[model samples]
Target: MPVRTAVPADLDALVALELRAFTGDRLSRAQYRRHLVSPHAAVLVADAADEGLLGSALVFFRKGSTLARLYSIATAPAARGRGIGADLLAAAEQAARRRGSRALRLEVRVDNAAAIGLYERAGYRRIGLYAGYYQDGADAWRYEKPLAVP
Candidate 1:
């Protein structure tokens, strides 16, 4: 899978992947449109030559802050278990570094073992927890990873 910055043309595929991959707390089409053009955020997608979009990762950077937030990441069901999520994550980290962020933080549903494993394998450490963080009333575990300054 090749990862690159998302463009307006990717809107439909991105929205479809988000809808198929997540059941709640999903990003709206308008939000995705805004992020695709926002200077404070990076929307990245992993594309397959034949399959369109395989996954997407959204990261947000705040002015004067070294920490970047990995707001959301999702892989299409058909692309799961093939490392698409990891590829998007690595790309998100690089996107953050390019914007001068030194660390990346994210929140994952406590029940999402796959996502938790992906983050942990990528070197993110659990720092805290948020109760009732999801629309479905599930708790979220906060994780962070310090990016190496290049």
Candidate 2:
């Protein structure tokens, strides 16, 4: 369950996890490659020696902005309920903080109770809602957490 910044070598596993974890709004292989080197983005992955990649969290930051966006987070089907999501989340927050972000924001599918619970348990507050936010027209709940300065 070691979580680390994703590298180019992790591209394949990252894409695989993305495909296995979500049915829609999936990140393409090219996007994963781009994010791996993007100065404004951080792709963090949780991997094990035998399990390959357990999960990944993608975060985006903007110049001069104190807020970072948790663009996506996915845990492999076989790795769910193992706290991998939470671990990836904590790693994402840390990545954002390292970029000088004072707050982190994310949008989760309204029907995804497990994700909502994870965010809530991590101290993220429901800020608002976005209508028809997903590819399948599912609404999303906006959540935000203020990161304490370290």
User: Model 1, range 1-150, lDDT digits (tens) per residue?
Assistant: 899999999999999999999988999999999999999999999999888899999999998899999999989998899999999999999998888889999999999999999999999999999999999999999999999878
Worst 10 contiguous positions by lDDT, candidate 2: 44-53
Clashing pairs in 1: none
- Tell me each candidate's TM-score: 0.98, 0.99
* Stretches of model 2 off by over 4 angstroms after superposition: none
Model 2 TM-score? 0.99
CA lDDT scores, all candidates in order:
0.94, 0.95
Candidate 1: segments with Cα more than 4 A from true spot:
none
Q: What is the C-alpha local distance difference test score of candidate 2?
A: 0.95
Which has the greatest lDDT?
Answer: 2
Candidate 1: worst 10 consecutive residues by lDDT? 93-102
